[model samples]
Target: MSRNAKINTLLLVLVAALAVLPLAFGLGDHKEEPFTGADAEAETAITEIDPDYEPWFSPLYEPPSGEIESALFALQAAVGAGVLTYYFGLRRGRRQGEARALARLRAEADADAGDEAASERRRV
Candidate 1:
């Protein structure tokens, strides 16, 4: 295959491996809750270290269940990804537009120079 195609395929494979390898190997299998968030783990650790510890503040809003909390987290991630995608797309489009404008300007200048040369030849 072509160089670019090979590179793209390699990147796709690497991304898939990154996503799959951790799950496949069960990297966090030793943990009590393998898929638990860091916040929950930290809370457990803190409470274990200090039984009478009290929080200075609490969340303004809390989801009713773990499923809802996961859903909200996923939604937040999706929104963040969308925002980043939009920003990058906008930047790419602007770059393409600027490149096209520069190319058009160069072509016009060359054409104008050619026309001037023809006119001078006719005058001579």
Candidate 2:
């Protein structure tokens, strides 16, 4: 395989290892609830540290179930990622377009200079 292919393969393998290693060894299996979000953990820690602590404000809409909540969280992440992807893609496309336009302008200028040079050669 080519060098790039080898590197890509190695990276994919590394990612697979990272994703599976935790599950294989049951890293969070000791917990009563596996894959709990940081918000739940933070709430637990705050309540333990100060039972009288109050939140500045509560969310206007809470999901009915953990599954729905997870779906909404995933949706939010996907939307944010899509926005970032679109913005970056647009920027890259504009840059490439500008580069192409510059190259075409240079080519046209070079052609015009070459024609002028040929005309001067004929006069001499």
Candidate 3:
């Protein structure tokens, strides 16, 4: 193998070894200890919550029933489809406008060339 290739391989290996060495050696002496009185108190407080409190859902405005849930899903899908369709339509219209502008410029250039040719012919 070439010297450069050997050097690159050695560098890559060195980086990988360096990266792993810290992670391997950084697992420094972990010694487990029993939880203290404060830890026990905190655990107890968490477990002692009032049972009567109503749970809060992730999304608060979720529909409760089958029909309502289906309607909400359908509404969301329709809105998404509408937005996509509008965006695609706008993009398509812009492309069409650009094509029209290019065609108009080409036609004007052709017309100007024709006029220039006619004027040259008259001068002769």
Q: In model 2, what are the clashing residue pairs, if there are any?
A: none
Candidate 1 vs candidate 3: the TM-score winner is 1
Q: Summarize candidate 3's per-residue lDDT along 1-124 as a digit string, tens digits.
A: 9999999999999999987885587543352433334676665566678545543656757688979988988999999999999999999999999999999999999999999999999999
Candidate 3 local Cα displacement, residue 19, angstroms: 45
Q: Write the per-residue lDDT of candidate 1 for residues 11-93, one digit (tens) a residue.
A: 99999999899889999899776877789889989999998999999989999998998999999999999999999999999
Q: Any runs in candidate 1 off by more than 4 Å, and if so which?
A: 1-19, 52-58
Q: How high is the CA lDDT of each candidate model?
A: 0.95, 0.96, 0.82
Local accuracy of candidate 2 as per-residue lDDT tens digits, 41-123: 99999999999998989899889998998899999999999999999999999999999999999999999999999999999
Q: Give lDDT for model 2.
A: 0.96
Comparing 2 and 3 on TM-score, the stronger one: 2
C-alpha lDDT (0 to 100) for residue 75 of candidate 3: 97
For model 2, the stretches where C-alpha displacement exceeds 4 angstroms are: 1-20, 42-59
Query: Using Cα atoms with residue i matched to residue i, what is each candidate's TM-score against the true structure?
Result: 0.67, 0.62, 0.47
Q: What are the RMSDs of all candidates, in order?
A: 3.5, 4.4, 14.1
Clashing pairs in 1: none
- Provide the global lDDT of candidate 1 against the true structure: 0.95
